[model samples]
Target chain A: MGQKLTPGDSRSNLYNPQLGMTLIVKTVTRWVKGFIFLFGVYIVLYGHLTPGGGFAGGVIIAGAFILLTLAFGKEAALERMSKTVASEFDSLGALMFLMLAWLGLYFGGPFFVNFIQRNLPGKRFHLFSAGNIPLCNIAIGIKVGTSLFMVFIILSVLRVVVKKGERRMVQMKRRGE
Target chain B: MVTLLTVLLFFMVVGAIIAVETKDLLSSIICVGAVGFGVSIAFLFLRAPDIAITQVVVEVLVLVILIRATISRDVTAISGDREFFSMTVSIALLLVIFIFGLEVFKSFPQFREPVFTTMSDASTNTYIQRGLIQTGAANLVTSIILDYRAYDTLGEATVLFTAILGALAILRAKARKRTTDSSEGNSDQ
Candidate 1:
């Protein structure tokens, strides 16, 4: 989905109309979004010991992407990154998580066995603790981010292409040379 | 019983109105989404999550395709007045279809219990005893889905493969791109 949507700002495409937005407002939005995204990351990382997991945290990060895209124009958002690349990253992330789970078998254990163990030298209630919860969260975050990024990118690209074609035709008609 | 159904019916109607009347293409798409969601909720209150999910996902795909198609239309090319009459007639036919659809609901039995929960129970119990002894997983859904029902997963994967193949077939182009607006034409060209 993301592969279909991401467009480059070449001679055929658009420029960022919202980059000139006020610094204070933009700064605040970015800061808030960044913090929320980071907190979501924390949620996924410690999922084994905590209530939040990969899915919850992934959605939070997606929300942050949405905020960043809205604050800047779609072109600026795409300028910083490609949707195709993000989708590939998402697929790779899921693959790694499953691969790690299966890798447990090679270590003389069952699939998805919680092999790595470290204690706070105490109980099972620390953020730095939890065996493989963090790993699961990372997978979820990637899946969610890619899905949402695809949805938004598809909508934005479709809109931009139509607008660009219209503008081009109008410009050609007006030149009358 | 009647009141709840009536309220849902009314909501769908209003949503349809808003979707038709809206000027901005985005607003109309949103209204279409809202109408689909409203119907999904009604399907839920009718006690079917699977149905709700199906409707919502399909509707999302449809609305996205429609919005893209509409945007690609040459907006400057206005049609004749007869097109409006044709639209009204088609819409009236749609309302008649809706009336018949509601009547068809009487044929299905009311939700006594979720069929899957009961069906899943027999499979789940077997897996529970076998999984502990065989697979070491306590979660019945996971055990059944991954280990016991590996064949089903294979089938599901095959289904996904078929879908991707179909998409690839449609997306593939042999001729040079003639600058058609579709993503397929763009990429192939």
Candidate 2:
């Protein structure tokens, strides 16, 4: 219990317990990330009735993951959603969007036609009022959110590799000198 | 509104200059983020809440990415020898573009004015006048994007998908290894 400490000493393992930011950030994120994610879902679901739609909501969702990654390191964030799963979900989103359009085509209408709206238009200003819009918004939200997360994860991983490569180059140059 | 926009634009330009001229990569990223937030606020003043929200979140993510990439890799001595010359040339080009933009602004419509009602074509007018009844959506922008211009949304989604594919292809570790002897490449996998 009597461990001496100095400023900027990450090796102490007391102030810096893990491979992430301070404990305060991690604690705050644990409390706030769920709300951020839920707000993003709300924006996506109510996209047709509100100012934000799929893109905004999707970006918000990705922002939550990014915040988690920043606060708790990549390993914790990847535990929630691995890179492979993110990529697969990205593909699934695009496929779902395309399938929606193709279903419109198969139903004897033009591509992206509002067939559901024409047949059974629900009550106005309601959740299911727009025929294919909510579905499209969900698809786009899934696509944009997962792909952006993947992009962030990939870029961060690449940064590590780049740093290592640069260090190796510096070491080689010093050895040559 | 115009005054607010002018102030925001001025601050944004100042922030951009500071971001570009600074040597510290971290402070430069923060300055760029300030400029992005200013742009988001300007979007709000322009009555585009959708763009504003997207811009704010995207800006934060981009800032996080940029800072994470360059925070530990400080390269203060990497400035180009012709930095002053490049800066002068860019400023001159910007001034010329600003003059041309002012000329183009003369022919544009009034700010914040809905243009659909003034046009003679009644077909396009239906979206604004009867967008809710037709699409059963309250938000006109959402109805326009997901219904009236759905094919365009499809194209945008395809574009995003292609862009992510390109990013993954370029950034994957195994794809860049030309030789099998590199231990670093193997370890990454």
lDDT for each candidate structure: 0.56, 0.83
| Most accurate candidate by DockQ | 2
User: Model 1, range A1-177, lDDT digits (tens) per residue?
Assistant: 122333343322223333525666567876697686787687556544434455455556665665566565555456555777765766675576666567667766667654443212223455443344345447655665555555555555544333356565776678645
Cα displacement (angstroms), candidate 2, residue B118, comes to 3.2
Native contacts retained by model 1, as a fraction?
0.01
In candidate 2, what are the lDDT values of residues B55-89, reduced to their tens digit?
99999998987876776663533443466889799
What TM-score is obtained for chain B in each of the predicted models? 0.45, 0.81
All candidates: TM-score: 0.50, 0.85
What TM-score does prediction 1 earn?
0.50
- Candidate 2 CAPRI assessment class: acceptable
DockQ-based class of model 1 = incorrect
